[model samples]
Target: MATFPQVDFLKEAGLKADRILVPSDADFVARQASYWSCGARSLRPACIVQPRSAREVAAAVRALVSARVPFAVRSGGHTAWASANTIGADGVTIDLGYMDWVRLPSDEEGTGKTVNLGPGNQWGRVYSELALHGLTVAGGREGNVGVAGLILGGGMAFFTGRYGLACDNIVEYEVVLADGRIVSARKDGDHANLFRALKGGSGNFGIVTNFRMRTLPLPPVWAGMTIHPKEAIPDAIRALKDFTDDMWSDPDFKDIVVIGALIQIAGVEQAPAYKKWLEMPTITTTCKMTTIPQLTMDYSQAKDYHNTWFTATFKNDVRIVAKAAELHDQLVKTLKAFIPDGDFVTQCLFQPFPRLFGQHSAAAGGNMLNIERQSHDGLLWLAVAQVRTPEQERFAYTLVQDWVHAVRQFAAIIGGNLEWTYLNYADRSQDPLTNYGLENILFMKDVAAKYDPEQVFQTLCSGGFKVSNVKLPN
Candidate 1:
């Protein structure tokens, strides 16, 4: 494969704002060099272009296409893998970090309020800004995750129970095509075909420059986390089902409870004792919540930069929750017996999908989101396997995949409807497009061909969900 080659087009393209950042540029190298995939892995881009405006981004796209160089587009750089943001050999990078401006409409103006975010901006930053006006957009739970990836692939979060996935909330998107044309798209507006294709389509469609989101007035929603002891896995697992069943049945609970087990060696000399003593006791409780408060929660605390493997959905099957808990407990017990002293943490996180509770209670089209198309009567679960060590990491990842597969099987057995997969936390092996339904997937592919007839996005762009790639089994 072709590697990064030295290029001098950045300086020529960058005009008013300090947009184009070449490899040799000190600030560019330091700012755009690192990523958050595992533990701060760094890659050198041959050319890093920071477009201050959508026009600049369009120009950068044209330059890259003319050069025939492979390019990677980065917004928040919070993607779990390097391939999503890092540049290839001799390729250019369209880093959207410089785009962090938000515009809100005053309540008195009667013009529905909305916020425009740059791709590089994270959900946390956006949330903080939105909170100033007592508003909260349905966004990803992890504050550090970028707005682009989350929305493009159907964002999942605590508010999703009442609002729906992130993609479902978007009203319009400002995107630059593979052929260097910039266009605006909305649900039923001009360029609607491209807009529909971009939703849950990953970055395969094009580089989203600025997103025009539909916003909602914020409410005083309660939030909390209740951790069950490791030893209480059996009871905790059972409780998990009861909690989600209540939410699925009532739809007003608006509660998210997570059950996690912390297994770690205490010290060098106490490693063995730590393992023996740490027998599956429930340790963290991050689940008590009612309505949101005026002040925002510390966004930085949402994640600890640890590697996480997760899968989720909205279904009214309590058995899925119970099965996940049981499987997690079994996996932990198995690890304890085999490794004897391995350090690992496993969590079964459950949150309700938005629109499950009720309506937005505010004006429509405030943000560029679509929360109206959701069926709220369901429970969504995420069986996570997390660890810090390389060996433990591999094991945890494999174990989680196995558990999710088992859960999928169990869902089928229980006559549960299996739908879309959350794209942000999806594994490389999982097929998200299929989760969107065969009809939706096929429709997205047809729409994609209309916008990008040459398959420029499928063959050239870096990574994200691709509409043209998924082949359904007959």
Candidate 2:
């Protein structure tokens, strides 16, 4: 028999959110689509409640507590891997999608520059709104990824070199605690530990209803890929080394060079053959760029939507690239053994870490992110393999993992450590914080314990990153 408590107490608590989805409810099929976390394979919750306001959220939490029922909070349903969304056929879920209300806070600076967004507002919406101000925030690139997941997990953006992770730029968060109390936490305020844990530690603490982030100055960036034939693989690999080395040595040049690769159908049929796109000859060379809009001119032409991507970090040493390429060649050959038709899609992505990127300016006394917050330089490499359908998801994940592991092993051979995993783009099997080292890990766990002494966050919510819950080294 199920031991979980009943959620009927919600009615008396004055919490209204459409209707409570109980286990016997016929809408479970529709409700299940939102479980996109990495561990969604085994998620079966007892009930789901969609609250529209922060007050209702508090009321609902209080009701669940009164009934002694465990529940998970969800924003965009992007954190699919966590068991937090799943109620084990007897737990409850507090879905925040209904709370997607973005408005300019009264306390915002008079410039109308700073915007406070609801946790449900996706990055695309935020970008659209901020672009009107000739401004943008350093946010996730994907159009549909949620604001809550990214900010809570220390989101990495395309312009991180100029600003910092999404978490670093956050100004405030309106959170609902375990006891159903609503509180506003800032860089310097009461429950400062909660503010720090909210950044990068995932939703292991509480449910954040609204997030306040600093905006950035919008600029036309040089972006786009210059595709070359497979024969140019050797030069292309070497160019990866030279380009990263140059950026590291001359950090100011971070604007001039940002290189990444893609592998998929390449023809006018694949994407609209604009004159700029049509101009590239089928040859070997580096593609230089000057604007993002100009570069993504044919984004609608891309084939794969669920493009499999894995990232591995290499040391500041230039020799690591050459070593990585050698391993990359071996992995390519191994994968080729599976598909000899030469129709497979696989490529490496690399970015330079300039000196300016290391200016550790996180909220004071808040989330401690980045393993070596000082002068650590390396190429944040991504292995983007092709994906065409749901069936191919497993294959794509395996190939990406294999490539990252091989590259990390190669880095070890060249005297480099595989530290720092990007939260937004990393695989479920990857441990993002492990790269932060033991001292930082211990610090994060201590912070989590301080804010959530009852262990409500660590034991109840099983989604997102949990520093206190991570498996310790033997």
Residues 226-282 of candidate 1: C-alpha lDDT, one tens digit per residue: 355556655554544455445434332333444432111111221231222233453
Which residue runs does candidate 1 get wrong by more than 4 Å?
1-6, 12-34, 39-44, 105-112, 230-239, 242-255, 260-308, 312-315, 333-344, 353-378, 389-392, 413-419, 472-474
Error of 1 at 467 (Å): 1.1
TM-score of each: 0.78, 0.77
For 252-338, candidate 2 gives per-residue lDDT tens digits of 222211123321111112222122222334443334433332232322123323456577776755566665556667767765666
Q: Model 2, poorest ten-residue lDDT window?
A: 262-271
Assess candidate 2 and give its lDDT.
Answer: 0.61
* Top-TM-score candidate index: 1
Instruction: Give candidate 2's total backbone clashes.
Output: 12
